[model samples]
Target: MAVHTLSRRQIFGYGTAGAAALMLGTGAWSTDSAFAAPVLTGNPFSLGVASGDPLPDGVVLWTRLAPDPFAEDGKGGMPATPVRVQYEVAEDERFRHVVRRGSVIATPELAHSVHPEIHGLRPDRVYFYRFRAAGHLSPTGRTRTTPAAGSDPRELTFAFASCQAWQDGYYTAYEHMAAEDLDLVVHLGDYLYEYGVKTNKRGVTTDPKFHTETVGLARYRLQYGLYKAEAPLQQAHANFPWIMTFDDHEVENNWADEISENNESPETFMLRRAAGFQALYEHAPLRRTQLPKGPDVQMYRRLSYGRLADFTMLDTRQYRDDQPCGDGASANCAERLDPDRTLLGARQRDWVLKGFSRSPARWQILGNQAPMGQTDQDPGADTLVWLDPWDGYVAERNRLLAEAGTRGVRNLVVVTGDRHQNYAWDLKRDYADPGSPTVGSEFVGTSVTSGGDGADMTPQGEQFLAANPHMRFFNSQRGYVRVRVDRDRWTSDFRVLPYVTRPGAPVSTRASVVVEDGVPGVQV
Candidate 1:
């Protein structure tokens, strides 16, 4: 295919030559092959720069050149050929103290996205990086390495967010998150919604592509292009490194493993899933190891921040059993009581158990997609719940919690996102018994923009809080959760916004909760 790239300025020129050799930065491979710099027009870095998966020694830097982000063809208005992208990391914002500089090719196969996983740097320090391509210099992004293994770090401040449906409202939450002092951002799924919208919340006409739901590679790519082009989202990604995973809407609503929510043909559904996975990997700042093999990608992993905390990110959707009784607020579902039903397939469940036993970290943080606590949806004696979450797989939840409690895992905390409502639940050894021991704590965050300017409290929210005494706090609002952790305690602030349908909404902390060391439940 002949490659072509369009720029806003419509100016076209050949790019300058880059490094003579290519280094993967992951310390994986090196080649003396001549770098080929293609002709790129205008500014290709329209999507901006981002970094993620920060390790003790290195991090992944990402950038894609798309002058025309919403091009119907889904090429980001770039030539079909690969473009050589050069990057420089400096000790300071200015290039005067440059540290690491290298080149990587942005290939059309991945929609001209570059994920350079560079290594060989000092641990637990700050660095600024930028990208160069087609005579254009991308924006500078700040990222830092985690503390060296076994080293005691003083504190870590980060934010966790999810469910940003572009058409529902503006990304005002992201703009606020970008300005906050944070070390990292953990995105627990629903990065993009698969549904179509006629217009976004910004009161602008959406491109024609937004009228149709995404079903293939091209449509998914187009969807990402539209969201990534937003300046607020881009700024958030640029401000701090992110650890990402996907939930239902990234593929389809409440989709189980190899099963579509609408029950589309198995073959057809898998193909669409493949496209979603491929597009997600192409746009995300993930390591090469997590590349999709057909419809499967190993997204769950463990990240350690010294001996203070160990984060075990879970993939709740891909490996989950289908929801019991068709996935709504079911009054009584015996199918969910099956002992063999699982949310995290056998391998993943075992991984989590083994990691818990072996990790030396004082805090066990489960970075999860959905609420792990049993939510009694009905205040009456007849229990009801939305069955897509852990509530659908009671056996797995019980077994997992049993192990944590039995083994005496200290400070077991689960930070969750998906329900669009903020909640603090005391994870009980058995939800059936109100007086059961509290094995862990679950903090479920509200959505970034979903539910469209939610209220401070809904009637249903009030009802649920009253019914479930184990649930300490509940709020229905639009915002993310900010967390600060130290050796002594864990604090979570439920940040809120009054409106997202309109722009320039101010943010405030609606509620703040803490769990002291050696505690397994929420405190005032």
Candidate 2:
């Protein structure tokens, strides 16, 4: 794994050396002991930068120029190089009248990733932005701010997606997302999977290394670099602002608070978790509000789109009870619905209810990582199989929905991901009773990749669709959903790509689910 040679013009010799030295100083260990001497050459934007968590008055921007991504041997240090990266925001395509301009230093200790939260802009307005490094201008990106508080927006269009596996396929879903008319994109976790394995090694147990994530700071930085390399993902980030939350795959599969279920001690897991959170903060274009407080990072936040919709993004992993393994025999089985079981902790639950009760927006959307529907394990099993989703926290889900009804919150929609399949269902008070009242509606998007080796749904897909009457559309395809929200109605077109293996593949509408503003559920 010799370092890629750099051309004279492309090279940043002294600058790279300085940054590498800074990195080495920050950490006790070398970045790359495995590769004798790490030659830094990859472009900073090889993994692109993105803006997210848009505010009416501003937007957060992010970028990392990893000249030597794997330099730290996983300790997350390199020589400190004071590399000045310039950024510009404009109202138009022309270079004239650039609204915003600034240069930020890319320190080697943070893997040269810059997280800049830009403010002082008009609300509900679109702006173009780009970055310059070492006399090189990266691709131009378009982003917008949310409407001012209390403003009456007639319509709000946003997209939610999750589960992007780098090796599975090309990010065609993001390409389609860029073409759509969206105000913002909500990413419900798995922004990047820790898994890295050769395609040939993928079998029943894919990624033989079992999700080789970048544990320390340097590895985390490289992981972000790998994801930014995907063109479609980069395009989507450049196209519109995003609201993001991480699912378990971002760190490790099914990792809960302190305990990892891997027999690791709480101290060991927390240290790793800290590194994961730090890397996430470093790479994402998130507001300082999202920054961690102490060892715990709170990702629960709210965003409103004028009077049209209010989006509540949650953290399902943090503050969650360990996934109930229920003994070794039923290790995969999430424990049966317990009244005391909770998904969102007591405080967050209160916050959600309070937000819903006070929301002036017509539509209240919950951007979440997992499904809200009751997924029965044995097809027609009367007993609901308690999975890691809302199903596991029955009492909590019921309370939330009941509160919505009690407070007269109309058109509650939950956008979800993580099952790696497309599903649309009418959220009900109870799945056991087919005639239960509809509490809300849900649109679950399939994975960008990572369910299987291009394998579509089979028995479980068929049975779940049949058993669950409210479930209208189900597909195991690899794609995303396009959502259009308005005062009168909200429409979701489930778009599926032919395959993710190739680039430039055309996408088709698999199904459409629409819900009138006054209606709590969908009309299919």
Candidate 3:
């Protein structure tokens, strides 16, 4: 693939009078007419448009010019030259009140993707945006900015979800999520599974284009293109701005730190990881600061919604120690009890601790990828636990919980997604001590389409709650979690879908619970 670098003068020229003329004129670039272009054929906006990472003064708008998204070489059917794309941010959906309009060059170096960071807008308000490239008009997306810093907002509403495997099932949950009135959507990792497509129990056939596992940059880009091409998933992206972080499956299964599950050399694995991180940046609506540097991408950051809620999104997979005492479930493993082991490297741990000590929001939320509560798979004298989760990093988990209590962080809540199961837990300072005080609460959402049509409840799921007293509720269905936070209380509804093996599945709430401001446990 060819890469074209942009000059400073060319970039400045595109952002000025040239962009304004395209937005205000009825020429070849008009949205009302279709003019033929030599470089692009058909519709260049087939991949759709999205906006994410909202801030108090601005938001990020994203789109890619892909006439044929599944091009084998991963150029997305774009030419070698950089294309100038125009974007508009309007106060209304009909473009009558256009607030900001600019143009940016989508170069081959970044897969022809454009992320225009629009600024100087009113806070705590909604805005509509769209893109125009090569005479094709993209879908209009709506986004909202947070209230100004130190300002007290009345309420905040959003949804958090994860784990959407395309071959296993359809994305029916996102269809329902698109219809809900939410301020933002938080995706807690597993955005695109790296494994090759295979037949599942539902008898669905794998797509021929994605039958091979993703290895290089081209394959990774193709995987994301395939997932984003779904209409329901595209609808969800168009409806609300999203905040996202990654888990293990984005690159490979159960990868931790520099260790791959297949035990490849560190040099070989880092190349694969670089590909994954680069594709994630190219496709997602993330800011330019998150651009990948070699094999590392800085993902953990804080976002505040005025004084109502503060979100600390974590990157649990990047700096974690390898799973202790082998990979799978085991009984009474001594390696897991190592005090020096860490999940969030020392620097990130200190960052999170300082966030807790200095936050001013009414609700301090942690958008984590894995479950923070202890979960035992077997209930016998010798308990068995999954080494991939917090059960393996007991010392770090206890240290974080103790710090939260010492700092007096009020209304601390954690929202997680990884295990394809919904759970509500009263987070204890010490899980080994039954009489320990509950320090906070955790709401773990199920998957979007992973695991393929799970039941309402399973026999094993019932045993989980019986063994762990802190676990209050459990459901093994596919859906997302809807959360609403006010000054006095916070509520979460465990939304569930009936089936995902086929299309057109209706969603319903399986359970709902609330946590008072001063209380640390869940109320049914």
TM-score of each: 0.94, 0.86, 0.92
Candidate 3 global TM-score: 0.92
Highest lDDT model number: 1
Q: What is the lDDT of residue 135 in candidate 3?
A: 78
User: If the candidates were sorted by their lDDT against the true structure, best first, what order would they fall in?
Assistant: 1, 3, 2
Model 2, stretches more than 4 Å misplaced? Answer: 1-42, 70-78, 200-213, 325-335, 384-386, 452-457
lDDT of 1 by residue, 1-524 (tens): 11224321121111222111112322234445565666666679988999999999989998887887788888988988767788999889988898899888776767788788878889998999999988889999999989999999988899999999988898999999999999899999999899887866757787667899988888898999888888999999998999998998888888898788998866667778878887888788888777666677889999889998888999998888888898887877899989999999999999999987898898899999989998887788977877888888998999999999777688899999998999988999888876789999999999999888899989988888877889999999999999999999999999999999998999999999999989889985
Q: Considering TM-score, which of the candidate structures 1 and 3 is the better prediction for this target? A: 1
**What local lDDT score does residue 225 receive in model 3, on the 0 to 100 scale?**
86
Identify the candidate with maximal TM-score: 1
For 1-524, candidate 2 gives per-residue lDDT tens digits of 11323322232223555544433322222233322223344455666768888888988887766554444353223345546566898988665768888766665555566666677889999998888876566778889999998898877877788898777777778888889998899889888776564552123243233246456555665676566767888889888898999988767777766557566656556656766776776677776566543236779999888888889998898887766654122213435356777788888989999998799889999998888877665554454454567776777788788888988898899999998888888988876566889989999999887663344566878887776777787888888888988889999988887677667778888888999878778877
TM-score of model 2 relative to the true fold?
Answer: 0.86
- When sorted by TM-score, best at the front, the candidate numbers are 1, 3, 2
Q: How much is the lDDT of residue 244 in candidate 1?
A: 92
Give the runs in model 1 whose Cα sits over 4 Å from its true position: 1-29
